[model samples]
Target: MKNLFFSVVVMGLAACSSTPPAPDWQLEAKGSMDRAVAAYLEGNSRVEAAELARARAQLSRTGRADLLGTAELLNCATRVASLVFEPCAAFEALRPDATPAQLAYANYLRGQAQPQDIALLPAPQRALALSAGSGAADPLPRLVAAGVLLQTGQASPAVITQAIDTASAQGWRRPLLAWLGVQARRAELGGDAAEAARLRRRIAITQGSAADAPKVLP
Candidate 1:
């Protein structure tokens, strides 16, 4: 009876454990923006537009206007706009908060920023490491970081290579492709011409010929 009582008490305590709050506007906005971009990239324009709309609405509701200026939020807006072919809206959205790196990334995604700008913001450099800001399940900030790396030209070789290598070793291939694709363009700008070419070739093969690969052809 005592053991049962103790076990019940422990279970009750565990059930009562508190969860942390959501991130502030900066992280929240970035996360929403990242989802919008991902939807766009995956050719889901409806979901992309909805996410972008949600992000914009959330940003508008925020009393903390300065949160938009952070590296995370602005980059997310830029990536979503670029993917959805809404460059003007994207630039307008980020203009108020654009850091030099952020602006450069936006412009590069829009085909206006210089290649050098992209190269400078490498994969490792672009990631805005979030600590204690958001929950681990929130992939938004990481997705935004990935976008920054992508916009700044650190995606292909280092970023994708790292993800693939990690995924291969960990058997985490499902999320790896989408995550790595977000960063692949960086290699295209960072002077890894051969690597970039190879990556593009792989992408093309996947897009064009993946269906042809022998599987249960039924």
Candidate 2:
């Protein structure tokens, strides 16, 4: 009887040890998105692509997709792809009924393909787009807005500076680097060699650090 009881207990322990824990889809999705953004910022296109695939996989496992969350993922993908490919189709496919923050991001993405449309957007929409990520919980929009404003010649240096400062304070390394790149371009255009050189140096340091960081996706 003692031998039989001991075997039963051992078998129960093995069963328990072999059973896998349930997955946390939400955490998986968030981590995937974070890693995607980090990879994109570091200019690691291969890693970015893999991380986005992972994000989509996580979202798929959640059973029901969150429209806004999906849109955010698409936005990041579009932004990164814009570096080497035309992303207007993906931008255009984003849902129109997003929240104010999301709408702002959509508009910024749209602006990349159609500056004229951006100019014709309603004043309120433009305002939201310009201030998309500022004072918001997410820092990506601010970076997007700043890039849009700088590229479109819609924002003054002071406004861009404020966006950069806000992103920096929020510890958004990627957006901060993007904003600095824009400033560097503007400096070069204006014949401010010293300013351009300083900005480039900062960009190099930031990119190096980001590249050295470990991959965050599972």
Candidate 3:
């Protein structure tokens, strides 16, 4: 996910001996998906919206509602990595047309997936989709893994710190602030006032607000 090589997902495609020529949608979707993710994590909402719209349009070319739903799932996944927990309303609108695989992925993203859902997940997501653990080395995957762990009631201080460090190292302000906020909250709950203040300072610096950092974890 961090490297973004696996950004575009060609939903409902079965593996074949020889890969066929890439579809126009696949090519366009991949680039758009990559940019959308980078823009979202880097805190550029305008670019993220435009790129995600472009990717959705490309996926719509196939006339498969499931693909459209999958596009929304990808968008929600990026949002989740940045600690956004709103319902995936876009995917919900297309749910009636979605396949079991699509539903499985939706559940996986929501932390309500079943054991069967793991196989339906993209490779980078499978490890965390399966349990309370991290998998890939890429910063995005780790951030995603940390997000899932937090969702599943399994995140520890270490998980939050790692996610914060990963986002900071990548200069991903959105997730960096989000994760820092979470760490600060945890520190507050644990009576580590000094650590909490330090993290709040970092969050304030990022957001240009000296006020109390907003709650990003609930």
Candidate 4:
């Protein structure tokens, strides 16, 4: 009887030892995302890419549906970074239960991918979709709406100028530079040399400030 009990105990211990422990996927995913954001803010593209890859890998291992939205957002951002304009499958497959802001951002990304598809929605509708912000949350949508309006030639230059000002005040570096370029071109085309020169100077100042800013890593 003692021999049989010993054998059973040994077998149980062996089985337990052979089984692999499950990963804490939630913590892994969060950590990877945090690192990715830090890398992006620090302008370390290689580290950002690696962190995003790690996040995707960790999310993939879990097989949890809840992580799908986050995974899709990361994938879409990656596509944008690579300048890949095709609509992201993950974004297109967003669940209907997603928040209004999420849906608006997804739509913006989709519009970016399909610039030639003009009939996606009217400019006003697009603007309305992105208009769900109060206080500091408003700059990105306003910038996106301004870009859309500029592309479609639906808004006056003043509207775009206001959007650019709002974005610049909020310290958005790249978008401000890009829109300033657009405005400079418009000024040149309209025979306003002084305005164009002023815009160019603004661009230079913004670029210099961006260069001087310290990068933050988490």
- Give the lDDT of residue 152 in candidate 4: 50
CA RMSD, predictions in order: 13.4, 14.4, 3.7, 15.4
Candidate 1 local Cα displacement, residue 61, angstroms: 1.7
Count residue pairs with overlapping backbones in model 2. Answer: 1
Better candidate by TM-score, 3 or 4: 3
Q: Rate the local accuracy (lDDT) of all candidates.
A: 0.42, 0.50, 0.75, 0.51
Q: Which lDDT tens digits does candidate 4 get at residues 52-157?
A: 7887787667554335554565445433322234665764665554444345445555554243322343343343434421223234345545554554555477
Q: After aligning candidate 1 to the native by TM-score, how far in Å is the CA of 79 from where it should be?
A: 6.5
Tell me how candidate 3 scores on lDDT: 0.75
TM-score of each: 0.37, 0.55, 0.83, 0.52
Count of residue pairs whose backbone atoms collide, per candidate: 8, 1, 0, 0
Q: What are the per-residue Cα lDDT tens digits for candidate 3 across 102-187?
A: 78778876878788887877766776655565655567767877887788888888888888889889878889888888888888
Candidate 2, 130-181: lDDT as tens digits:
4542444234444455555555667678757876676567555555666676
Say which prediction, candidate 2 or candidate 3, comes out ahead on lDDT.
3
Residue 138 lDDT, candidate 2, scale 0-100: 33
Q: List candidate 4 stretches off by more than 4 Å.
A: 1-51, 64-108, 112-127, 130-137, 209-218
